[model samples]
Target: MTSMRTLPQSSPTDETPLVALRNLRVGMPAPDGGAPVIVLDGVDLTIAKGEIVGLVGESGSGKSMMALSMIGLVPPPVRVLSGSIKLEGRELIGLPERQWRSTRGGTVGMVFQDPMTGLNPVRSVGALLTESVRRHQRVDNRRALEIAEKALLAVGVPAARERLSAYPHQLSGGLRQRVMIALALVNDPKVIIADEPTTALDATIQAQILDLLRDRLHAAGGLMITHDLGVAADICDRIAVIYHGRIVEEGPTADVLRRPRHPYTAGLLAAVPHFGSRGSRLEPIPGQPPGPTRERAACSFQPRCKHARQACALAPALVASGPERRVACHNPIEEAAR
Candidate 1:
């Protein structure tokens, strides 16, 4: 087994990782009389102050689930059975809904994947933004409106003053996303959870949105949930590759992309288009992700792993092997393999 890297732990007073989760397990009731489904199992993650951590994996890999769990937003049927979610060292797991309501959008903001779902179609962008500011701060309508306009302009929305009156349906997709970001940042949250913020947008617009988010949140530090390895490499200071509810490989973005230790991580990187690539076909990881109904007693990737062995039956924990790298594979890919 290769040794993993050990990075410096942020100081307790840093106020970074305004939000964090450790050993989180989200479960759902089973249809029949059996154990509840485990959507997330033993997940440990951290987002430091002024740092961006990308959670990358295929769909249903529990990336979004992890984000939702942090803010107490897991949808119906799925419940957080056990875990420790802390925001600035304050526990958030068992907090009541009222407390969560007070904390969410106030201290910790979130940006969803779809603007239409996140924004209110009936409400004008200005009203939504102003409401968010008013909800958290003890400000009157005039001050809230001023803060809203400033936030909209801060997000690069042109003529923010006039655009504030426009409803979400009247704006372009890119503009709507900008509004979503404006709303998320209006309260000056210490942390932001952006789940697939670039989904469904064209490459050009996607790049623009990503750039805006990266630049705007550069100092606040947050967690970005995404499936695009390219985006992860571009924006995240570090990347963690999740597979079947557990992180398989995690390290500095440059290190992970250049030398993926886990097979799944390698496959994801290989799938990204490279400049001047010659006849290199994108390789997809064969086999479907394990369904919620499936039992997870052993390694989740064993069935699709090329190096699986009898030892895979015993699940491997994420172990450090470098200054800033960790992998859970019994047989990790070496740097020379790629």
Candidate 2:
């Protein structure tokens, strides 16, 4: 079994990864008597302390599943079958639900993709924020309310005191998202998992929310799951490109964006528009992601890769190619000689 191994004793620095997922595999039982359905396959990722790690991929690429697994929020029909999720020297995977519940919001907070689904429509924003504060801190309603309002203000919501009394629907999409962020940060978690936090807002609003999150959460690290490479480039220190539930490449955001090493990663970057690009005609990756039910052996992306060779028939493990980059491909992209 692939195991999560830490580098022999290293001090905490801007360089050391704060959270690490090693050889992670999340799978579920197949409905028609077949091999287990693999949603996340032998994935490995690292996020430095106080750094932003962006996980990017097309739809159904298991970006959200990976995020949910980190915080023990994987819904039914999916389970973490193996691997270790280490956060600040503690293993999170395989921990009992009770233990995870105790540590989740306090140690690791999460801001889901859709604020509407995450927030309680029946309750006012104030009630929801207060509840989050009360759950983690030993404080009365008065103190919790104070903390809740402070959280709102921290996320840039004006008149936080008044906004707390309003229902989720009363706020704009951007405001509701800010409230979501406030709830995530109420307990001052060490790591925050934001899954497409800006999906529902306008481009300008999205930029604002991303900026706020990047600024306010600079002290604590973050893992942002997004399909937009532009967003990732704007906010993340490093980028991990996931294709068909597996990470094909990972490196500094600038490195990966400028010189993608995996075919899948290259295809994704090519599909994005550039400043000098001709028209708005976007070039999407051809073919759909493999079905979750399919049993995968060889490289899952071999069928779609333009550079697939005989060696690709055997799955490639993520291998270190440089001090800060890794690629899982038999035919890796050649780095330009300086």
Candidate 3:
């Protein structure tokens, strides 16, 4: 793990950030004495109050790891070498486990990608929901149950009262996800981190879940992690494009989507399927992302970038490219086609 270091921040707001992660580096052990396989490298992000920031990237781009770090749930063996996670301007890097446990579901609630993984199979949904609220809020069983029912109803869980005794496997995938969202909201946390909340569901269920999160779930701000840019564009106020553990492009959703500066961003957008486009073939990005253990000196995407040049031999730092756009490329793409 690298040492925690501070970096220059580029935030849209001058006011304090609700959640700020600066110079965060995370990695796993290498075969020998070589550098650790860097999973996250000097990532800086800010989520202001009332803002919904989307963290979009491929499978191994460190999206979920960043979310776990926020909730102090970063899995072991993958250590956070150095960086600062601040909540309301308070540093959380060095917080004791005792304090982190208190902060987990209380200050920051997480809605994982799959409820099947996050939920207990043996326990009834009612028990799972009530347990979450009870952990953060001091309430008796009856009141905890009441909060659970309200939370379920708020998330569109049908027959909320009757569903309490049902096991997670008994409900459909959509219903189970609704319960997860409900559990996350029951605590009324100040911030929410949703890691691919709509991943495994069908199209209809996905839309319904997104609608619920966007319209009903209220909090200080949110960090939504997903591989789908369309989903990000649909719900996020801003989007941060991560490639090889680094944010290659970030800006307002409209700006990034309308005028993507990074070739990687353009590549991702080109892969999306537009509505009413019958018989249209979806363009997929060529080549797979480098493995986690693969080391690189220059641009990680250089091998795949059509516009890569000799200058890219020296890696580029994320720099301001437009009024609200930042891109980390020696030769970034021009504004995206309208």
- What digit string (tens of lDDT, one per residue) describes model 2 on residues 1-338? 13323543344444446798988999897778677888998889987788899999888889999999999988878889899888875778888879898778888888887876778898999999898788889999999999999999999999999998999989888889999999899889999999999987889899999998887556799999999999999999999999888898999999889888888888887788889878767767787778774567799898888888999989898888787999999998777621
Residue-level lDDT tens digits of model 1 in 289-309: 887644888999988888888
lDDT of each: 0.86, 0.86, 0.86
Most lDDT-accurate candidate: 2
Model 1 lDDT-worst window of ten: 1-10
RMSD of each: 4.2, 3.1, 4.1
- In model 2, which runs have C-alpha deviations exceeding 4 angstroms? 1-16, 31-34, 279-282, 336-338
Compare the candidates by TM-score and give the number of the best one.
1
Off by over 4 Å in 3: 1-14, 31-33, 216-218, 277-281, 336-338
Question: How do these models rank on TM-score, best leading?
Answer: 1, 2, 3
User: TM-score for each prediction?
Assistant: 0.93, 0.92, 0.91
List candidate 1 segments past 4 Å from native. 1-12, 15-17, 31-33
What is the lDDT, from 0 to 100, of the residue 336 in candidate 3? 46
Better of 2 and 3 by TM-score: 2
